[model samples]
Target: MTTDASSSFPFCPERWLSKGIWKEREIPAATTATATKKKKKTETKKTTTTTMTTGRALEAFDEGVAAAAAGDERARRRARRALVRACEEEERRIGREEERIERRRDREEAEEEAAAAAADVAVVRAREIAVANREAAVERRKEVVTEREDAVAVEMAALHQEQMAAGGEEQSRGEEE
Candidate 1:
C-alpha cells in the first residue's frame, strides 16, 4: 500500500497542491478572522492605558502651570509649593508601596524562620521527654532489683536460724543420753 506524501506530511508545502486537500479548506479565512480579533483587542487595551497615563500627566502639568500664573508673588509661591508638595506626595506614595513590599517580604521570612525554630524546639522537647522516660524506666528497674535482693537476704537469714536451733536440740539430746 502506498501513502500520499501530502496525506502523511500535513505541514509540507507539497500538500497545498495535492488532490482533495484544498477543495474544502477554510484555514486562511479562519486565521485572518482570529488575527483581526486579537489585533482589535490588543489595540483597544493599549489605547485605554495610554489615555489614562496621558490624562494623569496632563493634570499634573496643568496644576503646575496654574500655580506659576498666579498674580500675587505669595500666591504664586504657594502654588509652586503646592506643585512641589504634589510631586513629593507622589514620590512618597511610591516609596511607601516599595517599603510595604519589602516589609511583607521581611515578615514572610521572619515567619518562616519562626516556624523552623519552633520545629527545632519541638524536636528538642521530644528528645528531652524521651530521655526522661528512659531515666525513669532505669530507676524503676533498679528499685525492683534492690527489692528482690533484700527479700533473698531475709529468707537466707531465716533458714540459718532454723538450722542452728535444730543443731542445739540434737546436742542437748546426746548429752542427756
Candidate 2:
C-alpha cells in the first residue's frame, strides 16, 4: 500500500485530522490561537521565524510512526513525548508574557490615577492661596480707610479750636462797643 504525499500532506491545520501530531483530537477553530513549533538546527538557513511548516511536522510524525512499525517503539514514544513537552513549554512562556502585559496595564492605570490626584491637590491649593490673597487685600483696604478717617478727625478738632478763639474775641469787642 502506497501513500500519496499530496493526500496526506499537512498543508493546513484542517488537513491534519488524520495523520498529524495531534492524533484523535478535534481540530480547533480558526479563532483559537494554536500553533506548533519545531526546533531549528540552522538559524542562518531560514528567512522566516517559523523554521518548520505543517508539512515538515507531518513528515516527522510519519517517520516516527514508520520507525515504530519497524519495531522501534522507543523512537516513536520519544518523538511524541518531545513534541508534547515542547508544546507545554511554549504554553508556559506565553502565559508568563500575558501576565507581564496585564501587570503593565495595571501599573499604567495606577500611575494615571496618582497623577490625577496630584493635579486635584494642586488645584485646591491654588484656590486656597487665591482666597488668602483676596482676604489680605481686603484687610489692607480697611486699614487705609481707617487711617484716612483718623486724619480727618484730627483736622476737624484743630478748626474747632480756631473758631472758638475767634468767637470769644468778637464777643468781647462787641461788649466794649
Candidate 3:
C-alpha cells in the first residue's frame, strides 16, 4: 500500500505539497527511491554542455590516444604534435599581428609628418613668390616715371631751338629795312 504524503497533511495537502511542505507518510520502497534519485541525477547531468575551447587541447590528446589504440602510430604522433604546434602557432600569430599593427601605426605617423613638412615648405615658397612679384611691380612703376620725364625734357629742348631760329629771321629783316 502506497501512502501519499499529500493525504497525510492536515492542511489543504495539495496546496501545501505544491508549495514543498514536508509531511509524514509511509516510506517508499528502496528500489523506487533509488530509481527516482538516479533519474534525477541523469537529468541534471544531461543539461550540462562544455562551452570552452581550452578543452580542445585535451580533446586532441584524447584523439591521439584513440588513434594509437586503433594501431595508427603515425596518426597518433601527428595529432599530438599538431596540438602542441597549434598552441605555439597561436602565440606567434598574436605577436606578429601586434607587430604588424605597430609598424602600420609608425608608417602612418611618418607619412603625416612628411605631409606637414611639405605643406610648410609650400607656404614659404608662396610667400617668397609674392614678395618677388611685388618688388618687380615697384621697379616697373619707377621705369615708367623715368620714361615720362625724359619725353618732357625732349619737348622743351625742341621749343627753345624753334624760338632761336625765329629770332635770327627777325634780325635779318630789321637789317634789310
Candidate 4:
C-alpha cells in the first residue's frame, strides 16, 4: 500500500522507447483461381501497398492519451481514498482525546467535591471543639466562684465564735465584782 507510484506505471517510458511500437503489415486480397491463372500467364506485377503513418500515429497518440487519462483517474482515486482514511483516523484521534479530557474533568470534579466535603467536616469539628472549650471554661469559672464563697463563710463563722466568748467572760466578771 505504501509503494511508490512510478512502480505501478501502465507501461514504462524507458522500456517503451527501447521497444518501439510498430504497425502491422497489411495483407493483400485473397487470389481466386482465375486471378492466379491470369498471374501465371502474365509477367510478375508488383502490387503497391500503402503504409501510411499519420493515421496510425494519430490512433496511437489517441490511445496513449486515453491510457494516460485512465491512469490519472486511478491515481486520483487512490489519493482520494488515502485522504479519506487519514481524515477518519484524525477524527478517531480527536474523539479519543475528547473522551480522555472528559474523564479527566470528571475525576477533577469528583476530587474537588471530596476535598470540599473534607473541609466541611474539618470546619464542623473545629466548631465543636470551640464549643466544648467554651463550656469547660464556664465550668471552671463556676468552680472558682464556689470556692471563694466557701472561704468567706468559714471566716464569718470564726469571728462569731470569738464575739460570743468575749461576751460570756464580761458577764462573769461583773457578777463576781
Best by lDDT: 2
lDDT of each: 0.56, 0.61, 0.59, 0.57
Q: Which runs in model 1 stand beyond 4 Å of their true positions?
A: 1-55, 58-93, 169-177
lDDT of 4: 0.57
| Tens-digit per-residue lDDT, 1-177, candidate 2 | 124422332232333344444433232333433334547342323223332333344455576556656767787666555444544544465588799999999999999999999999999999999999999999999999999999988889888888888999999999999
Displacement of the residue 133 alpha carbon in candidate 1, Å:
1.4
lDDT, candidate 3, 76-147, per-residue tens? 667667556544554465588799999999999999999999999999999999999999999999999889
Position 168, candidate 3: lDDT: 83
> Residue 6 CA error for candidate 3 (Å)?
48
TM-score of each: 0.47, 0.57, 0.43, 0.49
Query: Comparing candidate 2 with candidate 4, which one achieves the higher lDDT?
Result: 2
Kindly list the per-residue Cα lDDT of model 1 for residues 29-144, writing each as its tens digit: 21222234654563322111222222333343344445444444555454445444544554565588799999999999999999999999999999999999999999999999
Model 2 C-alpha lDDT versus the unseen true structure: 0.61
Task: Give the top-scoring candidate (TM-score).
Answer: 2
CA deviation > 4 Å runs, candidate 2: 1-73
Residue pairs of candidate 4 with colliding backbone atoms: none
Clashes of 1: 0
lDDT of 1: 0.56
